[model samples]
Target: MSEFDQHFPLFSFPPSKVPRLLNPLVLAYIGDAIYDTYIRTYLVSLPHHKPNHLHHEATKYVSAKAQAHFLKLWLPHLSEEEQDMVRRGRNAKSATIPKNANVLDYRHSTAFECLIGYLYYKQQHKRLSQLLKMIIDYKENEH
Candidate 1:
């Protein structure tokens, strides 16, 4: 078990019951929350602690454009099955898009979030951590 699994002990759905059965958008919903929490936790661990500063900093990583960028970087590295999940997410239509976000970026971001949610529900915590860590490392090196 990964260190994160040991510490957090997620009550994931049975592997046979979810992911395939759930809607891609539903997966994106949970994935969005999970990703946001991870980003918030990482920011809190840094020198900045003020709520406003943290929120601003978080937007850099959590925005649709940023997520789409990360997804593009990750595509070549993903397994075929993982890529399928991303495809499902990217193709899933939504009723609304944020005014500030490009449609393509928004779709890609949903794809990214869907992958995150799939991993989470499937209890692939180690892989999830690895993928999320890649984003953190990439962002840290960007400055």
Candidate 2:
């Protein structure tokens, strides 16, 4: 295991070996949880807030619609390889759709999740942090 695997403990298997072999949808599967954890942890670390209020705040960042928006905003800034990963994810076939999100948003969110999974698997934590911070900072500055 690499140093990251020791510290973060993202998976049972090695990240380098799996990312290239896993399907985009499979990557998104893990990515959804990873992204949710990040958002929840961030919210919990903020100043004291009620559980109900925190859940609501977390939804703002974790929802499919919100993820789609973030993906759209960040797409142009991604490298060519990153863009290809997003495309693979966006075009991936999924059997189910969420009741709350439209098809477009769902696909975009999957792509976003795939991007997150890719970064995580590749151990590109710095790039992932920068991308996530860019989105959060932009949203904060907007309102």
Candidate 3:
């Protein structure tokens, strides 16, 4: 019933080759959008929150620093394939950095986005939600 349902592949794979994934970039791409959606949704869910307030709050959580924090939390739970995905995304060449963020932070943020994108595109909605929840929980508990 979600957009993710429409976008991601919803098929079971053969038992033999189900280690991780062949296309890491795909994950990154989808993960980026998925992550943004969650952040925006989270902000919009707040009661009486104006657009500017929502944008500011979401920005804090979606920043490179915040994503880097998530990567640290996510690192321990990843398989070799997932790690490779992160690495590829983190190290990917980009034409620009985020508005006020540094180069290194931007790369890490992009990698995190890519990972979310990958999982969403793969139709691993459960897995995708699990990671996003961690980010939300961490942020919620931080304050």
Candidate 4:
């Protein structure tokens, strides 16, 4: 968290490590940052790519439509427990949508991120990596 984040607490975790009701929207918020970082990392690892090329590649995968598509691909693979988490995140009520995203698209993206966050919180690194690889694979195959 940076100074701006500290000053503006858009979402704050409850006092408990695990709240009675996990907020999927909050999970999505965190996942949004994580996802961007992951995409940038992937782009940076590629040799001989210009900054513009990397940005385009990252944008293609991170767009609302792409994230929603990935949600469909990954949702079936989650364990029962993770499915519950995803459900909570998906059904979470939220007041705002991203400026660039429509309501349906934004909600779907949030749901997908919530699933990723849930997996990460559970320390299911292998599972998360596998799911992410599927998403990346789709992006690669698109080219």
Candidate 4 structure quality by residue, lDDT tens digits, 1-143: 53222222234443245632556776777678767777777778778489888888788879887788888888777778777776787778888777898887777887888877665555555676777778878777876
Provide TM-scores for the models.
0.91, 0.88, 0.78, 0.79
Candidate 2 wrongly placed segments (more than 4 Å): 1-12, 15-17
Clashing pairs in 2: none
Inter-residue clash pairs, candidate 4: none
Candidate 3, residues 96-118, lDDT tens digits: the string is 67678888888888788877766
Alpha-carbon runs more than 4 Å astray in model 3: 1-27
The lDDT for every candidate, in the order shown, is 0.89, 0.83, 0.71, 0.71
Measured on C-alpha atoms, candidate 3 has an lDDT of 0.71
* Model 1 alpha-carbon drift over 4 Å, by segment: 1-3, 6-17
Model 1: lowest-lDDT 10 consecutive positions: 6-15
Which candidate's lDDT is highest?
1
lDDT of 2 by residue, 1-143 (tens): 54333334556665545685779998898789878877777677689689999999888888889999999999889999789889989999999999999999999999999999988888787787778778668877988
CA-only RMSD, every prediction: 2.1, 3.3, 5.2, 6.9
| Residue 12 lDDT (model 4) | 42
Best by TM-score: 1
